[model samples]
Target chain A: MRKRLRNDILLIGGVLLIAAAFALIFFLTRKEGAYAAVMKNGTEIARYALSAEGEYPITDGETVTNLLVIRGGKAEIAEATCPDQICVNHRAVSKAGETIVCLPQEVVIKIVAETKNAPDMVV
Target chain B: MRNKKTKKLAFLGLCTAVTLILAYVEALLPPLWAAVPGIKMGLPNIMLLFLLYRFSVKEAAAVSLVRLFAVALLFGNIMTLAYSFAGAVLSLAVMNLLKRIDRFSMVAVSIMGGIFHNLGQVLVAILVLETAEIGYYMIVLTVTGTIAGILIGLAGYLVLKYLKQKEI
Candidate 1:
């Protein structure tokens, strides 16, 4: 009986830990930067902002998906290229220290708060 | 009876192939609503668990190596391969060692493997990124890995149980 109780406790604890982690990710952060396009090889490929009230189209010489979503006071690609479309399913990102990357297409959408630049002190 | 060894080798190859296909399939799943990104299903893991119970440890390790390399090559990520390779080797070693404990259930062993795998990957991530910030992600990963471990373990347990009952 003791062992069973211990196991139950452990399982409950594990579930709570996971829930807390997700909550921390969702709530504790403040809004950061405006939407910015991630340019590579001099091409506009990705855009990110404080919220996803706008639309951003992304392409990779083949397929294109117009990603739409809002996160952390910005708007960016909630989806993108290729048949799998897994990237499109990754909804909007809206928090500090959060990132979304499209490896196959070499596109990264990120948010940066304006106040983040205050760390100018030399290391 | 004429080619038992050859038959065994063929079975191993099939296991490895199935695992590779599953790995890619899971990789293609869209991430759910989370700040962090990851693949779903962990389908290849089902094969690994099957081999662990049905075959010897050496055979399971062999299948894992082939599947890992094949998936890495198809995915075209050498860096990602290194992290996964480290995790696979370490997790396999831990699980194999723990399997020797008479009282340890396969479920427990699988859970340990899952935990160690996350630890190995997080260690690699810390090394590759040259930052300690990634360590924070380990807590989240541990919870995820443990849940996945339990589900996969139960699947393996049921399969082994069925095989034993059928005497196959």
Candidate 2:
């Protein structure tokens, strides 16, 4: 029984260590986003530079409206017509790979780096 | 023999009910991390771990599936069902595999189940949302899942100890 307890602790410790390492790598490798890509129904509808501060309204037909605001090198959904309002409540994102998804509106706002080596297909 | 089979069935049914109730209670609680959609304390997993240890893998899997469908039918939509179904299946698979290997303790199996559960959900999110960008959330999810796993695993450990004492 004592051996079992020891084994459990060791296993949990190892997993926590691995998770911490991944988190550290994630934080260190996170880069400032250069563009906010507005995607509707899985397709990139528009791209706005994070360097430029502006507000863009993304609409899907007549039913949905998501107001995306870029300011201070960060992007956020300022207003959303969706009932949940989860997207509007999301915090501003400035790091590449951050995303604000309005599932109701099928709108996805993702941050991406403007890299010369930007892959044609990012998997 | 008939009486024993009836008892087994009754136990499985009771386990399923317990798991569903735990899921419902967790759902009622407000989001721990507003940024993440699927983050939860995974209270139901404690029950699942208990079932896994106290019963057969087949019984555990059956109860888990029933719980998933029941929860989805009562409180979730199609998307929720998709994410949860994927998570539950993957988590069970991992736990069962670990149990078969028989090297790690039950707590270790539970933790691995929790981590894989989140990974399974993330995979579904990537597919359903049609964006690979969601993969970035894996780091946060993994960390949270590990914590939740530890809590659930500890609870399962205590319960297992008590059950052993009672010879249940």
Candidate 3:
């Protein structure tokens, strides 16, 4: 019984350690993105450099509308016509690979670095 | 022997019903993390762990699949179904493997299952969204998954202990 308990403790400790390592690696290697890509229906409709601050309106004719704001190296959805308002509520994202998705309108705003060596796979 | 088979089938159905009810209750609750889309308490996983421990893997798999479909039909859309189906299958497979290893306790198994569940959903999200950036969400999801897994594992441990005491 003592052995079993010890094993359980070891297992839990190992998991925690692994989680901490991964978190540390993620934060340490995090890159600030240079561009924000506005995608609608799985296609990029517009791209803006995060170096400049601006507010852009994203619309798919009369069907969907979202207001995107980029400032201080961060990008966010300031307003959205989607019912859930999830994208608007999401925190501004400046790091590479961050994304704000408005599911109702199929709008996806993603941060991307200008580097040509961006990993194609993240497994 | 026939009677015993019938009883086992009935018990499996009961487990499935219980799982579905738990999933429904979880869905009714407000989002635990507003920023993430699929975060939840994973209440139904407690039932899955219990079923896996007490019964055969096939029986547990049956209950898990049925509960997924039932909940999706009642309260979720296609996207929810897809994400959940992937997570459930991956978690169950990992738990079953861990159980077979016989080295880890139920709590450890459940925690691993929870982490894999999040990993599976993130994989599906990446595919559906056509972007690798979704992988970044895995960090937050893994942390939340671990917490939820611990809760579910503790609940399962308590219930299993009670059942053993009752000789059920």
Candidate 4:
């Protein structure tokens, strides 16, 4: 039992160490994103600049599925028709690689790095 | 031989039923952390671990596949099925590999299982969303997975201890 306990402790410590390292590296490399890209059903539907402050309704056909709010350099889901409301309850995200995903709505809001030369508007 | 076959079938059926019930219970409960999407207690995995130890990798895998299809068809969406299928298969692969090594305990195997499960789900999320940025969640999910792994491992360890005398 003692050896088993030691092995378990060692395993837990090692795994946690790796996870901490991953988090540190992620934080060190993370930067503020320029665009809040929205995807519906796994395809890019729209992109909103994080620098801009506005409310954008992410519609699927005629019905709005999610209401996205960008303010103070952070993006968040303000309203969603999804049953879980996990995305709506999420904290606003501003860092690159941050996301607010509504699985039920199949809508994803991701903070992404700005392209060197951007197109006028894809959506 | 026929009697042995009957016993195996009965045991596997029992495991599948238990896994399905656990899946239902897990679904009824809310997410552990609302901010961290798809973080589950993975209560069903306790049975998986039991099967792996008491029987073999084959039994565990069979039960896991059945549970995935059953849960997806009964209450979940196709996307959910894809994510879970990926997670379960990947997690089982790593767990089986580690078990074959014979160095780590069940607790260790289960921790790795939890981690790989998240890895699989993250991969699917990336593919589905077509964005690498969703990998950000992997950081948080790893931490949550570790905690959940410890819980399931401890629970499984206790069960194994109790059943050791009877060899059930």
- Residue pairs in steric clash, candidate 2? none
Interface RMSD of 4: 2.1
Question: Which regions of candidate 3 are displaced past 4 Å?
Answer: A40-43, A51-55, A60-62, A79-85, A103-106, A115-123, B165-168
Error of 1 at A71 (Å): 8.5
Q: Tell me the TM-score of each prediction against the true structure.
A: 0.63, 0.86, 0.85, 0.91
lDDT tens per residue, model 3, B30-82: 77777676677889889889889887578889999988888878867787799
B1-168 in candidate 1: lDDT tens per residue?
648778878878877887887877777665543455442345566677777778768888999988777877777578778878988888888778766643456666676677678778768755654433345555566667667777877887786777655422
Greater TM-score among 2 and 3 belongs to 2
What would the per-residue lDDT of candidate 2 be over residues B1-168, giving only the tens digit for each residue?
888888778877987898888988987798887766667889999888887887768888999899888887897777778888999999999998888877788778888899899989889877877898877677777778888887898898787777655422
Least accurate 10 contiguous residues by lDDT in model 1 chain A: A114-123
C-alpha root-mean-square deviation, each candidate = 6.3, 3.7, 4.4, 2.2
The candidate with the higher DockQ, 1 or 3, is: 3
Q: Candidate 2: what lDDT?
A: 0.82
Query: Which has the higher DockQ value, candidate number 1 or candidate number 4?
Result: 4
What TM-score does chain B get in every candidate?
0.89, 0.94, 0.94, 0.95
- Best-matching candidate per TM-score: 4
Model 2 Cα lDDT, one tens digit per residue, A5-84: 67777877887787788778778987888888888778888888888798888876764399989999999999998766
